[model samples]
Target: MSLDTPERLPASLADYQALAQANLSPDVAAYFLRGAGAEQTLRANAEDLAALRPWPRACKDLRGGSTACAVLGLSLDAPLLVAPMAYLPLLDPAGEAGVAAAATAQGVGMVLSAQSAQPMDHVRAEGSNCGWMQLYWLGGRDATMQLAQRAARAGFSALVLTVDAPVHGIRDAELSAGFALPPGLRAVNLDGLAQPQFAPLTSGESLLFDRVAHVLPGWEDVAWLCRNAPLPVLLKGILHPDDARQAVQAGAAGVIVSNHGGRVLDGAPSSISALPAVVAAVGGAVPVLMDGGIRRGVDVFRALALGADAVLIGRPVCHGLAVAGALGASHVLRLLLDELEVTMALTGCRTLSDITRDCLGPSPF
Candidate 1:
């Protein structure tokens, strides 16, 4: 059975979080909430945003405030996009399809994870032609090409290649809780794709670096993958400016400044902290987007001011999905857009272009 729509809908991301926690089981909540190791990077991701103070302006014409922007030729009503997250079925049976309906209704883009519970075709058919597919180089070159082709055929406009995780991070919280994939859900998109198989380890070999490293793709492989994809390719999980430049050079159409939502590398720098250098490095060569620690409309404003072409939201989307099906997800998007509009009006910014660096104070970091 689906959850009841609360009398007062969630007005803030924190509200959604609390509601989601109350509705979902302990293991499901842990999968979404906990980060790798001690979660230092997770804490830092939010803390960095809290450190930045917006310099709001007053006494200006506010009649024309709008939150519209175009990224990589996709015109969105707001700069907000949903980040690709796996196993939406873990939250609700609707999964990626529910998200698509919500995103389409709200006029925003949704990045469907390759590790999703539903097939790309089914998810695409649900709603939102403004969808992008997130690809993981899981089964090597041939498998990667197959998934990209599938996404294109399924009407996905863009391909997001996640570069941060060659292997899963050490998620201690999930590990300790024995957080296994629930019985009914698995990566349905990857059903027929070839999967990597490793030889049995000898007595003394290291399990991580020695065994797993053999199957991982290198930087050169990234170029090859970019060349092969039919859709515009964006490299996600990029932090360093040098890597940003390299990605553009390697034919990446865009780069997302993310540290895997602080879920991949425990000590990695916050996406907000890394946004400036990467944006400067790209220098308008390609679009630079970001995702991590985006809760309030002010956080979205901060990211745009710091030089991101757009921003992606992760946990909040899941929070909505957990609380209600399609309705909850759509409501979350609306809340964010509403808050962003209010922020723009209050700050005397009339449009997306007006949300510039000058609107911000000096970075605390």
Candidate 2:
């Protein structure tokens, strides 16, 4: 059931997700949808977000309300950013390039994955000045530094170091379906690069510590990256308050409170659940951002009310990409922004700042 031009664009984010699954092959859809282990965290991400209720304030001056915000000195039409998601080529041949063009045109920021289908320069050209790059600590210090330099040269304003996935998660759905990356789809930016590998697991040695641990970078490496990198470095995949504190101490310009979208460490806490603590831990030293299970405009308002500076939207954008390339992706963003503005207007909040904790249900924080 391919969505044609008229039917391709969805009126809601959830519709986009459904249409994307309908259009993509089962293998690809499973690859995109699977979460790690038993998926407790995956379910929890949406559940926790749903638990948050908004308190509507009626009868206020609603003449000239705007959803614009400034994050890291960059003006955004809405306080929404496209999270760094990999393998856009799997969704459409236009890949990250198409998504980048849409994001730039929509006046939102985008973060290209370290594992993006296109190279840094091409993605940057497509995304224009609003593009940021998400980095994985590849192999060792030198390769990581080289990637950073490349991104800097490509004019990425910020560097997002994804610290959660030192190794891929145990995705049960992908395993059950025997899903594999299709031929011709590769992380183009990492072409010709040597990734760290580990020896076969020895008897009695845990797969996590013995195999995965070998490639993981430590806190000192994170600190070194902060000092050496040319751009502001943000530590993504941070959940714990302590880790958030450590990231700030290591000179991280910001922290993205995420559980790797519940794709890593399945039983791990939901990102929204972890966000408040991380926000408290940072204590305003650095901006705290969050991602995961953001499906609606009210969810965005809830996230901000819960102390997040901004929120990154992931799966919905991918859904849009899968459905109608740039058109679908940009429309998804526009829908969210439009919905957010409506939520603001109805709630009597004229500005993003007016959306404070009091606007939400009683907070545990």
Candidate 3:
């Protein structure tokens, strides 16, 4: 019933959610758990993924099979990575450092959020494996470039530029709960940068259009970052095929099909629903990754069958972290990987490459 009860262990990823909710304050839980608006897209992410059925095979040679793969030239034990989530210190005292340690222990990569509660260098030092830094536009090019360069200096291997959320989503749950960061914990990585200031809006003018939209990054900015960044830039939050193509044209190293975990744009398509088209758009020019509603290992297989070269997990790992810090987070990953291997064995997929669209049947939906 409590985080200190180490004897009780979560048997499935879903179990961690309840455990986490129990461990966290009600307001904090709402902040971490809710999606934008009506949460239609949030529910759809899992629902649409469940609609696809795996075409199970009875027998195969089943020899020399492995889940190992590589993304952006970095080898991985499985096609899994931790999606960047901000303010981990709110979940546990160990914070992002614990998550990084957990990812390292599991032989997967961790993408540290620009809004991370821990300093980038300290978190990177906790993990020896691949680490990526997720970047938000930070109002303009100079500040953004400074953060990217800091990640490079901290030993991060790549940069994941989140392009979808130009402004924060209308998260009803967070608003209702009145969520605010507790004192002494903040986005330490963003310290010393001047926050963007906007001119006062005149009455009857659109606040979003008139004041906020001007600072948003554009295609030219993506190209600029790709050309100048010390690390390879992967554009996350891509859903539309045209945008995917544009990302590749902008010289991106990869594209991540995400709706910002359904935390942005309530009616937007789930990452799973959008993956196939994004994959086709890029046409293998760059790796295509996705993150949304990945609750089980079978979901990971389903994503691969659709087109994602790899997948990132967000809330479930946080759930684990809330329950028992690094050990719980690592256990969540281990459970998923074990389930993925089992699903592969049943579907006759010996390696990640073997998990093709053929491994799937028509959607039950």
Candidate 4:
């Protein structure tokens, strides 16, 4: 059942991406590659990620291997998790299932998107025993509660409530490429009437978001989400320091410092750039994680050194899936884990605990 054979391809993340780029279509590439709106935050996600470095300690032993960390109370074999990016059915018919298979093979879990091409239940099936639901809260209490109950019934272990995208922002590439999730492929959990303000603005006039806009949830809804959910809830898209504190107050189990991969707000700080203050605000009351422009194993180390309890990956895994289905996805994950382990060994950090803020160089912010 193994889908990995890195022997025939790129040994590092960069090399794998180069191969993936040549194989993927331009529009598909642009969707994953381009940021939403102006993409200012998207660029910062990568630039800020590159700015931090881990300080290595040479004398200590590392044969014991890398640190396995947890988030939102889930014990993961590694700190990496697949961030929820919708429309996998477009990339490969397997969609979320493909991502789930690859994630399980790599000994990790994947957050299945509510906006998935496949139904959340089917996506959960692909990631069953290792799946978590990535929610963008729905119309009203009954609607939101219904999905939550279904996810719990489907055996989802957690909930990642995305707080960004209160309104679907402008995505230039999605517009330029003429991309829109078709009606047949609309988010099954969020169907409703279309509206002018929240409606898709393309020439195609895709009613994707419009049909579902009435059900969008806010802070009050977040509390309701956590209350009715059976498992831990991780509030994704947390940026402001106060938001982090408020999330803890609202009973969120954790927070992912994400800006929707720069797909929502073009001017927000990189998730990595926003980590420290959020971590400080929560003051260790809640676990803080991040996702955005994380393409390298070293990027994982950099995020950890900056005080992120864990990190999430977006484009690269999609690239892997797009290029070779499940096998390609697994390859990308394994490569990242291997790189993280190597860095941990070389830096004399043997456990996740050994990777602390002290190991980082001066703050880039």
Q: How many backbone clashes does candidate 4 have?
A: 2
Query: Which lDDT tens digits does candidate 4 get at residues 1-365?
Result: 22455356666667657766787676776777688878899899999888887777778976766566666666778998998888776666777788887898787768888777666666656665346788766656666666766778887878888878777678888789876554677666555422223544555544565555565666777876777678788899999999999898888988999999998888988888899899899999978888998888788988888788888888888777777787778889998998888888877789888888887767657
- Compared with the true structure, all predictions reach lDDT values of 0.86, 0.86, 0.90, 0.78
In lDDT terms, how accurate is model 4? 0.78
List clash counts for every candidate, in order. Answer: 0, 0, 0, 2
Residue lDDT tens for model 2, 1-365: 24465654467998988888888887888788768889899889999998988877778998788888887766888888999998888888888888988888888888889989888888777778346799898868888988888888988888999999887788988888888887887888877667788777667657658777767889999999999998999999999999999999999999999988888888999999898889999999988999999999888988998899889989888888888888888888888888888888877899988998788867444
Alpha carbon lDDT of residue 66, candidate 3?
92
Question: Any residue pairs clashing in model 2, and if so which?
Answer: none
Q: What C-alpha lDDT, on a 0 to 100 scale, does residue 20 get in candidate 2?
A: 85
Measured by TM-score, the strongest candidate is: 3
Position 183, candidate 4: lDDT: 64
Alpha carbon RMSD to native, model 2: 2.1
Q: Which model, 3 or 4, shows the larger TM-score?
A: 3
Tell me how far candidate 3 lies from the true structure as C-alpha RMSD in angstroms.
1.7
lDDT of candidate model 1 versus the reference: 0.86
Residue pairs with backbone atoms closer than 3 Å in model 3 (clashes)? none
What residue pairs are clashing in model 1? none
Off by over 4 Å in 2: 1-9, 362-365
